[model samples]
Target: MGPTVTLLISIGLCLDWAVRAQQDPLPRPTLWAIPSPVVSKGADVILRCQGHLGSHRFQLWKDGELRDERNTSWQQAEFMLRNVDDWRYAVNYSCRSGQGPLWSELSEPLALVVTGAFPKPHISSSHYYSAITPGTTVTIWCYISPQGPSHHYSFALLEAKSLEPLQRQSPTGTPAAFSFPSVRAEDTGSYSCVYYRKTAPHMASWPSQTLELTVSGFLPRPTLWAQPGLVMTPGANITFWCSRPKMSSLGEVIFTLWKAGTQEPLQQQISAHLWTSFLLPPVRPENTGSYSCTYMVQTASARGSEHSEALELVVPGSLPKPSLSALPGLVVEPGMHVILQCRQPPKTFLNSLTFTLLKVGTPQPLQSQSPAGTSADFPLLSMRAQDAGNYSCVYHERMAPHQVSDASEVLEIWVTDALPKPSLIAWPGPDVASGANMTLLCQGPSWSTRFILHKEGSMDTPQDVSQFSLTHVTPKDSGNYSCRYQPGTNGSLWTQPSDPLKITVRASVPSNTLLITLSCVSFLLVCLLLLAIFCHRSICIAGALHRDNLKRFFCCPCLPQGVCLPHHAEAPRDEALYTEVAKERPSEPSVSNSKDPEGVTYAHLNLRTLNKRQADPKETPIEPTVYATVSLD
Candidate 1:
């Protein structure tokens, strides 16, 4: 055969072998020590390897080199390691199974430890304190005094709970120190150390005494607050602030927001500052409940602070708003009982409803009530100034799926002493004549927007205004009047009563008769005075003139030249004088001598002396004159 054919034959055989190996794959075995892995000096131990039932041969390898081989028809094989007196007997040993030319995978390695060759070492932590805070650096040392002179030594740190070594190191001298940069709560446990020689007789010493470690208590509690307040509408977002006092350590802290009755947190955050914030999703009606927060130092430990004070969140549900009203009036004096009635709208179908009263700044409900009717009455007995505030109410079903209604319009309660006193006064005067118009002007504080005027004893309705006008006032209208005022139109408290003012109405008199009497008296006095003056003057003139000359002087020019004063002539002894003047015209015939004439004039004068004698020359004489007319035509 040529070389090409030989090579072809070899490739075919390899392919056949590969297919057979895949069809009959070997199983890996488990290895274990019959006695404990740690044996004292001069003790014997049996290392056992377990594999498939059909194993033909078992090979034991120590430290990656073949040590012994045994042919076995059973599923397991055991090898005896006798008199383990030196550290060289302590090494990694493994086994593999083989049938004919094929061998199985190697079993897991088993460690054989030799002890009691020397005294136990000493293990201790670097910290002098019993408990250590998380994130603090820690160190554990394993010390073994050397006998005679120092030799090459290696050490292993082991936890009491686990069989395997946690860490291994070669030390240049005694007392191997293992440094942990940062320790946590999970690092708290019992630990020990072992030392072994690094040369051919790698003998391990006995384990040192177990050292116990502990992590300290949790950090200080944090404070929590909400932004935009605790009460809010649905679909609004809110943020919670979790803060701690400025820490001396510059370590990261975790903030967690938690809801009540739940174990898991709603949100969590990590920040380096003294405070952190948590923004929540848009709220709904179901989100209205209590919440809290806590913080933990960001480390591998589970320790954290106590929860902060709980905060309540409110999200009012969708329902028709109720109406709120105060009985008697919105403005009332202190100590007066006021009823705030919250009423549902007409045709409300809900039954068994609960009504809650809420204030502006307070987070929780001030009071709650359940009523059978459509309205709930909250009676404020003995109201005080502290009870005054903006208030609202809401209603909800008492049963499952508790449906809540929207908040009612805010109603403010004013509790104070009645307003200030308002002054009341009559415009013209307190007294008025019958049938006279009178006005009562009422004045109050400058801030007062309303005033009320009332009568002392009358059934009339009180007037609500700044003033009252009363026309044609009668006795009935005359009464004591007072006034009160309110600060503003926003249902402010009413003021105390002002000082009362009395109104008087008097009867009037008739004026016509008095006017007539006065006129008559004045006319008579003027006539008497004029008569005395004329008579005195006439008498003075007569004393100086003759009787004939007096008649001529007094006669009318229209009379005849031969006419004489025969009708009235001389003066009487009592100093009374009379004179007559005829009325005749030149164009008419004379009728002076007739018994009845058309017209005649008469003059009478009377003069009186002071002592019935001649008057003094030094004083002027009084004139006495009187005139009268007589006519027959």
Candidate 2:
């Protein structure tokens, strides 16, 4: 009985001890993964679930998912992965201790790394050749074929030559994209990329194909061309030509046209022509805005050049008309400046319109930029009579060349510039002979239709002629003369007086010259009369010794046939008979005293008439001419 009791007590004590030991804490173990932290591709690796607790059975879990379990007699239990390339070998790992079909608290998670499990991710760019414009944003994406789960891939962009990485991004799905902002020219060079899982950070694929990334300066800007003209009308069809002034490469170009206030812009591309063309089927009033353009080389993911200057386009509806006005006075005078004003509604926008002045019969319209308040001023200096014309003005849009308001009421201008001072000239000299002809000439502008010649004393009536001519000029015709001209129909358009031209008229000959000529003629006639009387007396003494011969010497009229008739048919037969006749002759008075009548030299008288024949007559004696030689005593 005593022995039985002792055995039972001992059994109870043993049971108590066993029960206490069962209540003790299970083993908190640490896992030993063979080839942990980094593992080779396709290499077998083992996870040893070991614990300080007595139980040898264990379980393994990764990222909260059960990976494997095992129960063995050995204190160290191992879960083997035949091929390390399996996804399970590349994830977070942990172990716990327990019998079969039972589990313990999971051990702290263990991170594992599998090397050479994946090839490098494919690297590419948005551009055709992985080129980018400096100082612009660019995106590089690393792609893994057969895309993996989200947040499973980590990507890096590395400089190939240096194997240096700029930075890393958050884990993402396959084909992870990395953005580079404000890229610079120095970033250019050979580049590569690779990707790995967060769990196996050290394990990655081979480097992707090397990509040559080129960073370039800003691209050249393209030019914009609009159809028709800068000005346009509403609903007008227009075309635009965009081009690069020059080309340095064969790569294509992208062009974009931006509207001043609109979000969307027109875009186009070209690879061949230096220029590109775009067409607008029809325009609208909403199209009124400033337009500009920009461009980039297609090979460079479009870091654009600066935009062009904005070209204003306008399409006005129900625009206000402009009014025309003259400054100072409506009637302008020559040599004075005239001011013309064009005014539109003050409420109208200055940028939307321009002012213009139009004259009737004028081919060109005088225009100016719209003033700040819709008014413009024009000055017509040195007004002319020809400037007189119907004038008006209108408001028009700058962009729409032909779009304009109705012309304002006509404002007639009477320019007096044509009434310029005339020039005068005299023909035949300023001083002239009395009987000569003279002319006064007036000259002015060719437009002058009328001319007037005026004399100083005869101002009351001016000669209406181009040239004033005086025939048979006398002293009365000599005076101060001037001329003026008129242009157009303006009665007040007569020109200023021309410079005066002085003239003088003189008589035909001088009095002193005529008096001397008459006296010389009278003296010559007296001398001729005295000589004639002397000759007649001499002839009387020689003929007619009768009473007629004694008559005082007085000239007798010529006898018939101018022969003195010899006064006798026969003369005295002898010299004695002639002597008697001479003695009987009457004496005539003598004037000068010196020799008197004897000095006359007629005292010797010899008269012979032959009654007897000569003794020896040659060729029959010719009768002597009946003559008597008489002497004056």
Candidate 3:
């Protein structure tokens, strides 16, 4: 028996003693229970073991390493876990009596399943059930089991259904939280997260409860935009567009447009992701109204956003033409009261009325209003020239006060001063002579009927005279003449004096001188006429005398004795008378008669006559000489 055999014998005896000691039931083995096998990391878990008797102490071990030991007066033993990890799972633990070489039998293996690391970071929003404004920030938190220890955690966010990667966050301490800044509409969707061991990125755990993180506060604000501003002309193209605010993601937005106060929306379902616009190609006149729009999110938890302010629309049309009128049309003179009336087409309200009185060339305004109703007046003073001018009035409806009325036809007024003094105007100018048929005319241009002509410096008052005239104007008629005109009984001032008219009268021609000249010319004419008549009578008288002598001498011889002698028979008486004449003759006649030879018979007869003359002077004895002379006869 060497040292080796002695060692082997000693080891066998010790083993037998260990087996007999295990069979002895003086102190029973303690059993430890790991309560709540599944637990999140960084969380506290309890390992509890109880004994049938109260006189026992408990100790906890993991992989045969001492974790905790305690002496208790009660039958229960408990061990608190500060932090849990993957190494702490499937641990063998037991309980033992206090300070003794005796230990309890090893209890059954207790398994722990850590369910939390960055526990599926849940994303919550202020408005979780409704849409939110774009460009707003939201916060999400990572939580684990309530009993877990505080530890650092790393988190990530992903699309819920598609599992598309969205955002990742840095590691944070226990109860980790993350913030999304300036979120957009595209961020609106179903979202989820997971937790992983800090040192091992590939060895990640499943999400807790599949927390449905519906990200909000990322919806676009609905916009209202239209074509025209105030007036939308008929037949014009008008378009309305409903869109999200600019610089926002289109995938997260849904647009719907509606007219204000209308039950039916103008655009029913507008998916901004498809078109991003709601267009009304041709806007009609009837579509004029107030309009607005709303926005929605495209996530599983759909929600509606706020509406936009209303925008007004208007249409265009032509305005109607205006009309005008006046009150009294008869003689409108200064100093006489009259109204100027204006009018227009019948309308709802009297908005604008304007009245104006314009002189032909004046630039000043008389009167003006917005919509004119009836009339205006011009009071009468003593009518003057300046008051005479054209007058008119006009008006229109209230809504469009700027619309003007058609100008009325212009009217003219006649005004006059009191009766003017009568003044005379001569046709052939000034001076008139006497015995000349002169016309004296009395003329007054502005005289009011009653005109009187008077002599200047005369004692008599003015006579009711229309005109003054003289048949033969004399010097007496020459004087200063003045005329005045008055309207009524009261005599007014006299007119300016007429220039003095001088008339001169001349003497008449003598009657005798005029008759003498007339008689001399008449006598000469009568003498010439008488001489022509005398020549015509002389020729006839001479022819008649010659015929008578020839008939007496020749016809006497052929006649019978008694008839022929009878013609000379009265010669006896003639012879007696011849004897008497011969007796009276002188003897001196014989001497004178003897001078001519042919007169010898006359001498003898003369002597005889002388002798008988002497004798007969005394008696009738001279009959013998007369008988001889009678025989010769």
Candidate 4:
């Protein structure tokens, strides 16, 4: 038992502890308040730390700040925090286990947001807008308690309906403002915000109250017209027209007409145009009310709206009756003017009145309000047949309970301006091709019973039909043409002369020039057709022959010169020669000469022979015959 043995035991103990710690890895501990996290003032609470591993030491932490550390090998540890309810709020708790010195990863954070430690945040706005215009920038404010620690928590702005976060902010202080630019309809909804611990982003306080946002572009006020004029008698039908500016690209506008003191609208309509008419049949005193209207244009991504000022409908009982008369004689000719005068009973305060003149079968009336007059006249300029109808007038006081007078008796008038000038037009335009059929159409109003078509020079006798047709129009038929119409066979009543219409017939092209052009085109087409046919035949012939047969028949004259010349496929054969020459020289010469620039050799043979050695003077006998000429220079 010396010092060496003692040191060996110490090393063995350290190794054993390290091995056990690695096997278990120091389990993470959980902390919980003894009397629940929500408590009153001056209350004492115990933070009980528990874990699976029997650790030797436990450390307590509040809001990521270490509180206390105790050494004990136990399954549970409790640290008492007294008088926490006095000043502490929005506190977070966590714990970690330790084996001797090494510590485990921190446990999940617990948010102990005290019951009354902090005040709730409130959502506020300065102007409190009911409707906002698109593309306008807006800001919203969220105010919280002023006593919270800076950077202790972060803020999250969320949409309340969907619970989706729109923005997040790091806590610097209380009362944070969020800005939205180019606001659109999609931004319209309920909004709320919450503050969560910075260390534990998930643990958050209660959400603040929600605020609403709306997007609306400025829309012009709608125009309201009460047909038969706002002052109508009972049992008479009237229609209201609410029209606004026309916008082709906007969504369908929904028009709502509401009467005062009514919860629901009296009428609703959806249309794409700027105008909508609401008809109220058989008007009664009960239908009288101060009516106001508004329009809504809603789309998938945005919304727009406009509202009209209110108007009061006056349905009056028995009262004074007015008289109506035409200024000029009846039967007003076309282009002539006339006036209808309505004379109401003279009153001391005539300016406090509104006068309306209406015609039978018409929806609306001509309304006029004079500041100091008892008579109102409606002028009819350039009178026409449509303007000829029964007419009447009425008046109403401007005070509430709007006292209206009885309508005057009907006055009949006639507008002789029937059958407006007929329009003369030519088919296929005013210019016509030679020998082509042409038509002249005389267009007049439906009331016109008869139409007459005339040429400029033949106005005395005109065609009696509405249209004049020429099967074959020649140059002679081309002239100024016009037309007019009569009113229902009343020949005395006729429309003014129509604007002059001229018809021009063009001459035909020369037949010889046309024939030459056709001939040239035909010639070119024939050449192209021949070339195509030759090419097709050559391709068929070429493809029919095999590679081995190409050499001999390649010069096959049937092939086009273009194919054989460019490819050089038909030329001389490499195996044959055109000429041959041969020459024999004696190796042994009969005589030898010197090797010089110019030399010569001589050869001789016996002149006579018999058998192998016989010789005759006339015949030479030799193994071979040879002749040579010698020269030296």
Candidate 5:
């Protein structure tokens, strides 16, 4: 073989290998729609084919047949389908990219759906009302006419205004249902449905009629209140007002009144205003019950608001009025306990009585009590100024066919220390002579209706006056005194007490002089008793007469007027004898044998002495017999 022949054979092989490399296939391209795969009738669409950077040609295929081919310098080619309509439904599209003789594999297929190929279908919701309540299950049904062919059909639920399909369903039957387990506020809008054949040429029916769905229970609750008060006497008319919020949307509404224990509405009213009133007939005993109200938006799909707070209507006065009283009086001090008692009338035949205590200005009962007896007591513990008010009570049967009694008479309760202290002054001085008249003046605020003079250690009583007089002041009247003022005639409240003033009563006689006079008289009587004992002893020493005859005697003592002394005489033997000797002084000098010339009464005694024989004669010349008399002048 020659060198030239071998070189030509190598060149021919190299050239053949290069030509084969240029014929090999490239990587697959990507195919997608510009807006979406689904389009309404007569809409334009763009099918884009994207491939490798150096690719020069792109071919679009519909149902495996070449529909269009494009020569482009860019990496992606867009095929614009102008006036795309319903006949183009169920179209499967793909694309491939080419570089000279080399070509890329086909892309994934896309199903393009066109709607409105046949007559419109009928669309409906499970809810019949114009408005739907939230949290409820809702189902929308799309179906062809009954006469239409029942075959494999698909449905699409679309938002009419947005032109967006929310869901799709393919069912074997003629009618298809789309379900929402729990509908919400955002689900409220216009909705429509359409059906298709679900086959190669997916011919679709026109959209159904637009159905409006609204949600309820989003408005605030209305306010219900009664006119002429919650509690009323028999035969009184009441008007209940049901009012919606001012900012709520304006619409026709139906207001319904409902009794607590009954399911049926008591009344219903329709109005366009925010508020409306329901006037009830004259009330009776059987009319006492709790009430509430609600309003509904008056539309094809009516929506209702929450019920208002309960309003209780009380019709009392069917029975005779009861008596009400305050125990331990109406006036009480703060922190003290008080009982407001309601009692049934005598000879009343009602049973199972329940009592309600009502304050004058309070809309509701202050308290309730059901006693075993006919009376009920409402105790106010730790009473304060806030507890003071005019109160009354009414009684009713505990069980149904509730019969009520008229309110008892109003009772007023007062709490002391609501006012300032008053000033108490004594006229003609706090200290006055006994039997003199004195007055205690109470000065307080000009608004005070009455004054109360309080004496220490005595029960205080309210008085209407500026001065309290003491007719005959005595030691018994002496005490600490104070005063307080009451602002109302019937009120129990009082002002704080004034500073206490002490009263002292002086007697007629000087105490010191009386004491001295009593002491002198006592001493004189004591001395007379001693003198009588001496006189009796002196007579016993004589021993001349018989014991019975030898008696000692003395005169009674001279005493001042209103004074008297006791005198008695008795004989004593060999002992100190006491006698009371009193000298009676004559008014003028007199000479009498029985009395001394000095006008002083004297006691005279004569003694007989016995001498002893010779032995003692020389010792003391036998002292002459001596006699002595004792006297107290």
Candidate 6:
């Protein structure tokens, strides 16, 4: 009963435990879950088999007929109907699982409901109304039959033909609704919706009813028609018609005729489609422009269509009055130019124009057939007296078979010739000799002419001499004179005169001859004064020499009396003394001594007498000393 008994008991216990575990694996299937009641047709339906271990294989049946069987990898085996058909409506379906001896009882039957197809959505005619004019709201309804408590329905509005969804909403029951607050013409089209059951997986019902919607509102813009084309001449009557297809059947139409860009209608409130006629009776140049029309229905809302296309009115025949003016006024001088401008009123269609210049008081123009439009210039080349005249112009249009415009106002012109020669005449006749008073008269045929006079054989040029006169004339004043005449502008030419007239004037003595003689004497006196001034200058030079000698005499120092002596004959000693004396005495006179020294004096009466005595030895000897002096101190 030791190790052998213990090993046998352990093996038996392990085998028994294994047997019990196999007997108690998972519980076998007793029931299967069924799909919900009231499922929409054309939607998938599923059945589920649930049980314990060893229930891998299961079989599903519809009304006791085996529809499908499958071995399960899942805890519960599944049965599926791809899109339930009408034959599956309210049908009994069940499921069973497990092998021969261990097979489970059949599950309770499930009542499968296949709902009717979803009804197409519908919208009433009244559901399509406008927000403006015939202001109204639009309503649409989505309906599905045989409703279920667990079923949910949704409504949507889709664009016509495109099927593009516009809006969506959930409904509490089978029928759903959608509304538009303001309906418009654009809201007209097909609309649809769909429903589904919550109990069934992958079950969406078919589309509900589809409805066509038409929104009523104002008509689109009315088209316009006229009796003739837009451009018409004067006196042509035009009729305009306005109509719209939508509003054609409605009652009491009101039409209005209007010119483009103007709010006030030319005609209004006419009852017919061919509403009114615009009569351009005898239309003038001013009546041309663009025209249009509008149509309205006489309802409480008074809805109106947009205006029609424009029609242009034109006038062809009439031309406005033309006016002409010269740029610089009339009466132009020779060789000058003038501009003649022609013009018509504004907004007038002037295709062509012309201008002309005429002589005064003459119908025939001096210049004509000039180019057209507003202005032209009149050139008076080297104008003659005959070129002076009155000028006017005419204007016209260039349309085929040309039409002429009214004549312009007339303008006057005057032209004159160059200046003329003047005449010179001596008054008291040309026979008057020298020493006569005279006057010169310059005259021309017309007093309007200006006179100029010139003298012959003289350097002076001609000068303006309206009048000429002389108080007195001398022989030097004799000369021939000529004159030229310039006429003032009276549309006349200037003139030239004949050769100069000769006049003679002789010299006469004047009363101021004494004064002349006096002037001559005064001039001679002035000459003599100049000569005396020259001679006085020579005498002054001689006096200057004598004065110089006197100054030299006064300036000499006095000789001492003892040192000077006169020359004398004596013995040798005496002679020696005489030499001494001679040495002391000066040859020139002593300036200080008035008398000769005592016992040593010499005398002289005149230099000439002394010179004579010296020249002649026989002359008697004079006293040796004229006077003598004795020195005391």
The lDDT of each candidate is 0.72, 0.63, 0.48, 0.65, 0.74, 0.52
Give a tens-digit lDDT track for model 5, residues 1-633: 999999998888777656855665478899887675566789888899999878889999999999999899998999998788648545788999987656778999876767777788988889989667788999988888888775767788877744457788877776888898987654666888877776767667778899777666555578998887877767888999999864323457898998866879999999988899999999897777678998877766566778898776667756899999887777777888989889999999777777888889877666777788989889989888888888998888766777788888888786664545788899899999999999999987554788888899998867888689988988988999998888753476667889999999987677799889989999998889888775554443321111233333333333232432221244344434334323432222222424433222232222222222322322332223332232211
lDDT of 2 at 134: 72
| Model 4 agreement with the true structure over 290-353: per-residue lDDT tens digits | 6777776676643444557666675654558777888775557767788888888755344566
Tell me the spans in candidate 1 whose CA falls farther than 4 Å from its real position. Answer: 1-221, 233-237, 246-250, 261-264, 280-286, 322-356, 360-386, 395-403, 418-482, 485-633
Tens digit per residue, CA lDDT, model 1, 1-633: 999999998898877767766788678888987556656678888898888877879999999899999997898899999998877788888999876556888888876777776678888888868789888999999888766133476787876534246677787777788887887554666787777766545567878888777767756668888887666778888888999754433257788999865678899888888888888889776665567888776656656878888776666788798999988766667788988899987888789877777788886666677798888999888988777788898887665465678899998776655344678889799998988998888887554567777787664334456878889987788778888776554564567888999889886666887898999999999999998775654442211112322222244434455753443344322322443333331121122325324223333333465326644445443444333332111
TM-score of 6: 0.21
TM-score winner: 5
Clashes within 3 Å, all models in order: 15, 20, 17, 8, 15, 22
lDDT of 6 by residue, 1-633 (tens): 899999998888877756655675434454333333434566665677786654677877777788888886655787777766655344667777764234555777764535454434433333434332334566676555444542354445544333334666666664556777775544544665444443323234444456656445644455665556433445766566655443223456677777654568877665644343444345433444456777776767576666776654433334554566664655457777666665565677555443434343542344544365565566656556665555555443433434444445566554534333455667788757666788777775443345556676665443345566656677777878766655554434445554678877766657699899999999999999998775554331100001111111111023334543332233122111111123222233322234423223332222345424332444433333122122211
Ranking by lDDT: 5, 1, 4, 2, 6, 3
Candidates 1 and 6 compared: the better one by TM-score is 1
How much is 494 displaced in model 3, in angstroms?
66
In candidate 4, where is summed lDDT lowest over 10 consecutive residues? 540-549
lDDT of 3 at 543: 7
Native-referenced Cα lDDT, model 6: 0.52
Q: Provide the lowest-lDDT 10-residue window in model 2.
A: 546-555
Q: What order do you get sorting by TM-score, best first? A: 5, 1, 4, 2, 3, 6
Q: Could you tell me how far off, in angstroms, the CA of residue 471 lies in candidate 1 after the best superposition? A: 5.2
Deviation from native of the Cα of residue 419 in model 2, angstroms: 14
- Model 2 Cα lDDT, one tens digit per residue, 119-200: 6578887665545767777777778787555376666676664344554655545666778787765455576776666654
